[model samples]
Target: MKKFINRIFLLITFTAFAFNINAQIDLDTVKSQKFDTGKMWSFDYPPVEHFKEAYGLETNEEWFEDVRLSALRLPGCTASFVSADGLIMTNHHCARRVLEELSTKEKDLIADGFFAETLEDEIRIPNYYADQLVFIKDVTEEVQAAAETGETADEKAKNKEEKIKELTENLEKETGLRAQVVSLFNGAKFSLYGYKRYDDIRLVFAPEMQIAYFGGDFDNFTYPRYNLDFTLYRAYENGKPVQPEHFFKFTLNGIDPNEPIFTVGNPGSTQRLKTVAQLEYIRDVVYRGYAFVYDTYYNELEKLKTVAPERAEEFEDIRVNIGNAQKVITSIYKGLSDPYLMARKKDFQRKLQEAVWNNPELKEKYGTIWENIEKTQTELRQYGPKIMAYTINRRFTPQYFSIAQKLVDFANELQKPEEERLPDYKGDKLDSTIQSLYPEELDNLIENTKLAVWADFMRMQLGDDDNYIRSLFGNNKGKDAAEYLLKNSIIDDRDKVIELAKEGADAILNSGDPLIVFIKESQEQLKDLREKAEEISNTTEIYDDMLGQVIFKIYGTSIPPDANFTLRISDGKLASFDYNGTKAPLFTTFYGLYDRWYSFNKEYPWSLHEIWTHLPDDFDMSTPLNFISTNDIVGGNSGSAIINKNKEVVGLAFDGNMDSIVGNFIYMPHNNRCVAVDVRAIVHSIDKVYKAKRIADELKAGKIVD
Candidate 1:
């Protein structure tokens, strides 16, 4: 009996030690996940193939022909070639700015649905286009060759950049393509890219905002969602709708409850590569900056809501704005708070180090990459936050100051010789500013603009060393600075400011006032900010640059960055998982809306409208309303084609569950459910709810499935 007890104790000790070791290194030699049975993500159509396997398929010169931009850039964005002439598929919300320009009060296509039933009905959008990757080249050899010759880190980076640009330029002109070289990991490697752009995109179909954004902001990211935020836009060429061969057709039957489906879209950026030190800084400084601004805006929005609850529906847009801002705020806090994310980053970095050490060739060329990482960490900690905090505090200043500065610019231009002035200004640009600031619009801007106040607060707290602001306002105190702004600003009195512009038209411009003074003062900082910002912007260039470098250094081009929105595929499942300690229903119905309504005791927006009282009894809890799926996504992934194993479009990707927002930086395995609008539900809402069958049938979507 004593020996048995001793054996049990020994077993426990061994188990604990093994668990600790696993915790230290989570990666497995073989993925535990079985891609075949649980593979709801990859469709059978093209058959899933690893990049190398696919590359091997290129026999003879056909490989070069097949290796187009669309094929090379993988898992880039949730986009589709909707027409044969390169008409791309993306979200209406994604295309909101373009739609806004095409819309007029008489024809409110965004609020009301817009349909281009025929070719002539399509609306041409100005300066609206889709990005296509045309060429990709790995420039690690050239970059490393130059980097090896440099003494300092900065010199190494500069040398690598120059060599890469020279090499990429030669390759691009040789290929007759627009080429750019992107640098990743300080100066690890470079990626040369060529792009093809489709310029003439047109509006095809869009659901009304009420339908597209149903349940409004309150229901955003929460699952078993019932929103039908979907739109269809077409690409046009020479006044005709282009035919797209690569577009997926809508499937009426949808998919089985746990079928695999895939989505392809441009995921903006992911920080899965950052070292722990960098992430910690983000958690402490950058995230706090976001939270500070978000809190201020949230409070301001609440004030607006309280002041005008009578016109609550009118302020719906403001509420949406607040909700949108809050999601990122919540995500930042959530990411920082999640120790698992920090662990993942640490483990990934450790693996990178291991990979560096394991390869003798890598060590010879890279010369202590981990040491470089350590140095970067040390340098980043020294100056990163003060720099980051200073920038983040001014998130809203550019737009605000730009608008105000434009008014000042107009005043100055009026003072210039007539020939020197812009053609449209007519020495009266202030009139445009005054006319632009309508009461409702101004109120809306104010209601949505808590960031300005936050910025002032941040400046006061952190801007003591801000020589530029100190010089302009003559005081660096945020509060005092704000007060000075109110006193001297041309944006103060809407009417008087306009009148002055009309009176001393040239003097405002010629007076050499502090607006221009401040603007010029900020030039150096602004340039520095722009250059730094591009590093993290998650463009095709940045992605290629970073991932290509990592691959060249570590894995030798085996594992690629997920997708680049060209034609690369991704793998995911249609299975649901637990979240927030509750079993989310496979779907949400209008019954969920009623539940929230009664839960809030007939809240303003959630309460049933007089019209909704007529909803049929069967459209209650039993309705197979909204459902959760385990598809992966990120921003710029909207309007993606959510397809089943049969390669049929079952839904349109609109959003992800709120917990999934962190998928922006790191894709958490369990919570990254891709929230999409079921096609049948959308059709039912249009046909049954709004009685818009003509529009519904025009979409020609497949029949509904239970």
Candidate 2:
């Protein structure tokens, strides 16, 4: 009777499996959305028709030019001219490093905040500059023609580089501005951008880090935020603030729910154009390994803070950065793990493949591209672990190993003739190279901790039986191995390293130092792997360009190119979304800020500064602090100015919600949102909390107010 029941169940399971296999869905039936690639519309190819259809706004070239002129690109973030007298607005986090540098023994600007009462009071920041896009010209045909002259992938890549250099230099000479050849859609299109750089940037106003980064790591990337993440700066020229023709006026009337909004800024890189095979490699190997590295370093740094109390602040900063990276990596890994999202990506890839294979010209030119990419990814998977293990990542590997590697390279380079030496070791670059090779200070404890973490990662990835792992750690591992290596390695001492380097290549190579020996033994293998990877990359890039061409041919400018940190305009609406089984509001208020503070017992990250602890009677608790918009954004979109159709500043783009992390590969407008500091909150904070009436009055007047 038992055997009979088992037979019946096996029969039923087999029948169900057969039926499911027979009913599999066809690739042809899978549909792709228009905005699946996102609305990161390039300035070179603005989505005029789409804008008209979506917002009923007839935007022209003049309007785009004005919008472009108003925007500014910082070192790694974005900003905009908010007032006529060069009053620039950006996120507080973006200016944190500058604030630290500006602080003196008498004052801690980062802790107490800063406000320049008069024009002369603004502090000039050295080696800091902001770039305004002054001119743009399409140079696609010229670049493609140059690339076509090459007969091989390597030759094509070289020719393309040379052509871009030539075009950039020419543009710089013509416009008398910093010029760059911006590649769009993976080299399908190229545009020359000339930037009018403002070198004399000064800090005008900044909020305390406590408020700027309120809620801290726990609340980063989460929506319904109440943080006042904003700062003001002034761009000076010839000892005075220049009156810019184009700038966004700070609107007193705040944003409304579902209102059309635009974000114009330099969004960094995105991988929406990458092949499915490449994305799979990133999902399974690249990001996974990176996530592990970030997690390990972050945890180790946290532990280090307890032991190294004097450097607690420094360690905390590093930990915060690592925590942020870990979050992004894990989020991307999660997104890639989603079956539905992966299916959508597959459907989009299939659509592209069908479009190509349907045409004889495209099929002959790009048929093997996907298959070749898959083959490359397979090869990369084999080498990926080894590369990850040996790579001299600053965050993971000890500085002594890096210094040793540099010393070895220096000795080798010195052996070569002047003409045969690499650029870094020749002429004007030699002094800088030597100076960098011998640093003034070395943090022994931090470096050893990093080494221990790295040893553990290597053991995990490469296994205990692996040759290098076995040699480095016979029976011991982790902390023991790290200590042994540091104890035996003479490179840890700057004087010893300099002397060894001075003795020439033979002495450095035969040093028998544990770190040096390991580097030397793995040098040949690392070099070979790097060469092979570069070759594969060159081939992949050539095919990528071809794929880009086909994509452009099929969709034209309707599908905006993948972001490359060049200025772009993305359109969306101020909106709310569902999260954690509850609806997030379109805007959050100061009342919610206090709620979080009190809810957490006013402890740490959520704690308010002294000034913010007791608010004035006039300070409106109902004032909106932060808001959400469906606008597409990424890492580099921080400090982007969110603007309305009238070109008024509505908010400052500082972050993206958790859902937006997947924006790296695809944009889902339904849930993904840009988190921004409300412009009204900035005005109110300046007027009531900081009591900077001069800056507040200028922001209101859109000019310098006495």
Candidate 3:
């Protein structure tokens, strides 16, 4: 009897695993992958042309011209061309590197607005662009065939990679654009993007970071915003301001409250098509775990900040990271916690699965995909976190990673003979690049951030190593890195953190230090683990497809991905949303600012800097605040064009009402609204506060049209 019971238990376990592999989420049938010819836009309706037609009164053109020149997709950013001359528009957060380059202690361009009146005034960025998408193709069938080659997975992958390069390179030459092929579902579907590259992009204008990032970390997603986070960048060709044939001229007309608007730009990514089961897995496993881990870190960082208020900058820095991390973690958890959402998703998935299983056409479209997904998920669980952690802990540290990168590049060049080396390699270009490495003002910021990280690492890896840590940093055992930072006792006998910045090319090929060794060793580990990763990646891809398949089968293609720096047209009203039992206002005034200021007792980002104080008394009456009529938005939607029903530029989307935090993963339109800065408010602030009426008048003439 006991043997029988044991055998039954084993049988049940085996059956469960088999069922898990076969279980298909039914949510992947909403969107048709086919891109319809003749339609330049992807929204459910034709809002773009209608919007352009609305402007027909101003421009006597027969056809409503296309405002979107091109849309380009990057890993984290979605870029779109607004002007035929290739003026690129994306989120302010998307162009963070450019702003960072322009920042300084005496005049932080981020804190103080930067405006360029002429070409000479335009700040040159190291690498800047309006990446324009010139071409796109559906390579789904070809990639699917390549991936199914009977060769070993590695050989097959290599062959597929080569095929992708060959196809994209040929396309690039044919189209005279930079072409890239992106794999969608473990090679199930492929997207080919052709980008028109523009090298000369100059900063036209950027608002003060204080107003731009008003409310700071605490008030990031919270609504009723008073932030003016917007920037304008101009693209140049042949040193002249190239005129654009197709650009969305800002219109002065207001929006009809219920009219549909289309956002035409590169949208980042969406998981709206995921299976209920997959979402459940993310909610139960990933987000919850992340929240648990970060909750501790968040509290610890906050405590550390409180203990030493002198390290305010350092504290603020970490606080932002912590807050951003927590927002994501909590958002996912909240989405999962809602039974209605879960039920809706589950129902959607089930409907999709049934649709596929019942009909022969559907079965052919999506079958045998579930087994692959489970396998991939299992594999991904093994190394994804470790790989991600490495990038976070190591590659992100500028002092270490930048030097390592330079070393790698230098060694690559050394491999070639001196005669064959690329020209301009050792000229002003190299000097400029090296100069970028030792940005003096950024050093303190970098040091402070690294110090926080190092402290955390010590706490995690070598818990309570008080004596050892004290010996390493001498004075402030847990706080400062002054003693141990390069100049002190030997961690690599390296002093002057700036020295690491200087050793660009030699560190990788020449260094024998443990850090270098560790990096090399990790690369070896990655190489060894490639097969496992590929298998996981492939499965995840399959699962994602299946998830999409299931969702599409249920909900259709109306829903878009979470804001991933991609352009999406969310359809929520401009009204206030309720949080807890209280209603959040449609717009926040200067009173809220004062309330927060007194609340924090005039804190650092919240504390209005000197230039802000002398403003005319009338300016205190909410000059920078505005509301929008768009649907829910998230972090990636910052700097989004918030157009009116007339398709005119009314406001710029920046934040979401805090009451709508759940909108990060799910669009709860009844309670969510995209927060935007009124364009008029921005113009008013510039005219009144900055005393830049000349720039304002020019902007008024061309910035917005009736």
Clashes of 3: 32
Clashes of 2: 0
Q: Assess candidate 2 and give its TM-score to the true structure.
A: 0.88
lDDT of 1 by residue, 1-706 (tens): 9999999999999999998986676443322121211111111112324422423222222322221222212123345553234434555566666667888979877666676655567777776666556556667687768765666545655676678678877876687665666543333444676755557767766666654565667777778666656665565667665554345555667567745566655555445445455566666666766666666655565666677777656556655766776786667667767666555555666666667667787656544544544444554444444454344233344243554455555656666787887765654664564455323234434522532464454564356566545544555343455556555655455575555556665555454555444543454465675555443332223223443465445643233343223233444656666767567665666667567667768654454444455765444344444566776666656666666544556676788888777765566556668877666666566566656554455444321111
Kindly list the per-residue Cα lDDT of model 3 for residues 413-480, writing each as its tens digit: 64576567666345455555444433344454444445445544433332354443444444443335
| Top candidate, metric lDDT | 2
Q: Report how far residue 58 has shifted in candidate 3, in Å.
A: 19
In order, what lDDT does every prediction score? 0.55, 0.87, 0.54
Estimate TM-scores for all models.
0.69, 0.88, 0.69
Cα error, candidate 2, residue 666 (Å): 1.2
Name the candidate, 1 or 2, with the larger lDDT value: 2
lDDT of 2: 0.87
Mark the regions of model 1 whose C-alpha exceeds 4 Å error after superposition: 1-77, 82-89, 131-196, 307-316, 358-367, 377-395, 398-452, 455-568, 589-625, 683-706
- Top candidate on TM-score is 2
lDDT score of residue 234 within candidate 3: 68
The 10 consecutive residues of candidate 3 with the worst lDDT sum are 32-41
lDDT at residue 177 of model 2 (Cα atoms): 97
